[model samples]
Target: MKQNIYHQFITKKSSGKKSFAVLIDPDKVNAKSIAELVKLSIEAKVDYFFVGGSLVISHHLDECIQQIKAACSIPIILFPGSPSQVSKYADALLYLSLISGRNPELLIGQHVISAPFVKKSGLEIMPTGYMVIDGGAPTTVSYISNASPIPADKSEIAMCTAMAGEMLGMKLIYMDAGSGARRPITEHMIEKVAQHIDVPLIIGGGIVDPEKAYLNCKAGADIIVVGNAIEKDFSLISEISAAIHSVANVNAG
Candidate 1:
């Protein structure tokens, strides 16, 4: 229901204040179960909810979003893997272009197909340049997207890719190590990209603990996203949320 969602996020994070977000991949949870999790996530002080996945198996994307929206005050953002994963029911959509991959479908072709629907749906669209790094494992996204990830160890290549994306007018730069990644994106990579780009930096995938989240924050990540970890333990949202906010508050004070 909220408009100007991208600006809202930017404004919300001002003054070094951090927020907690939970990524809901519809492929992982059903409507009934997701509602239950939303309630628990709210109790965890999670700042927002992100819904989408590499492959959408759920028949109830809009319905699930509406159900969760009714249960929590947290804003829901769409993190679509393909154009079809989009639903107009959420607050905003992260319009991601996989800069790490040479595949034109993810880069622009898919966006072209989904653009009209997105605009007509009245959802806020935040243009983002998404770069997937080769985590320790071969992720479903990498497999389905059929694109190679930038080497996790190559900071210069990552920086150049991110810079090119920004030059092309992306609002945010997201670096994903892919879901269930054996390792999270390194602090060094985050620091390298953060130093180079002015836009918000979103880092997700394989972040399983608060310490790792703290490391991303320390490396200058503006927003951090976690999904699979919370799926394994609903309580993790609270634990990691508390850790990130505590660190943010400490730094601010």
Candidate 2:
């Protein structure tokens, strides 16, 4: 099993190093595309690969992970949208709890069902508090999870929710605007949530450009995850990665 992943996240946070992760939806990519992505990711020095999607309808999950594993050493973390998404091929799993929603199923029900398999799979578990923020347009996650997102303008609600999740022993806090979001989670919201939580914060969804990725890191996102945009244009991998890493350089200097 891949070890010390949570430690890596904490150590990077303590050192003010920002990470860029490319999110790959199994339903979206194939063996050839995975090979291409892995090659670009290696060139980009991308920090991690987040695998999974809100609604994966294909059997490409294991094949995708195997192809990447065969190609490079970049860590593959499962960002599963359901219990069925768990795979032994990945290095770790984001054991997410939808803390932002009122849906009991997503908050804990899914965890209960996936726990035994996850524990047996030997995947390092990262207990993440998942918060969905309104992104100006409806997303598959919101619709499928049957939960309304926290309003984008409500930073206080986001901050408090993160604090509560941290207090409840969550190792990380992930703020997402959902796939293909019309607007990314705001800098203000990221700052507020970062200030309130000691755990590493991951911001994703609707982050399509290098500038937004860079600004998000500056706003205290320990990790920036990009997906949909990259699916359309794989070249963004290097550009966005450089932008995120530049934050680390600035902090180090």
RMSD of each: 1.7, 1.1
CA lDDT, every prediction? 0.85, 0.94
- In candidate 1, stretches whose alpha carbon ends up further than 4 angstroms from where it belongs are 1-3
Reference-based TM-score, model 1: 0.95
Model 2 ranges off by over 4 Å: 1-3
Candidate with top lDDT is 2
Per-residue alpha-carbon lDDT of model 1 for 1-253, expressed as tens digits?
3347677667755667666678988878877779778888878788778898888886678888988978877889999878887787898889889988988998999888888887787788889999999898999889988999998899999999999999999988989998899988999999999889878888999999999998888787878899999899887888898887776777877
**Where is model 1 poorest over a 10-residue stretch in terms of lDDT?**
1-10
**For each candidate, how many residue pairs have backbone atoms clashing (under 3 Å)?**
0, 0
Error of 2 at 164 (Å): 0.2
Please report the candidate that would top TM-score against the real structure.
2
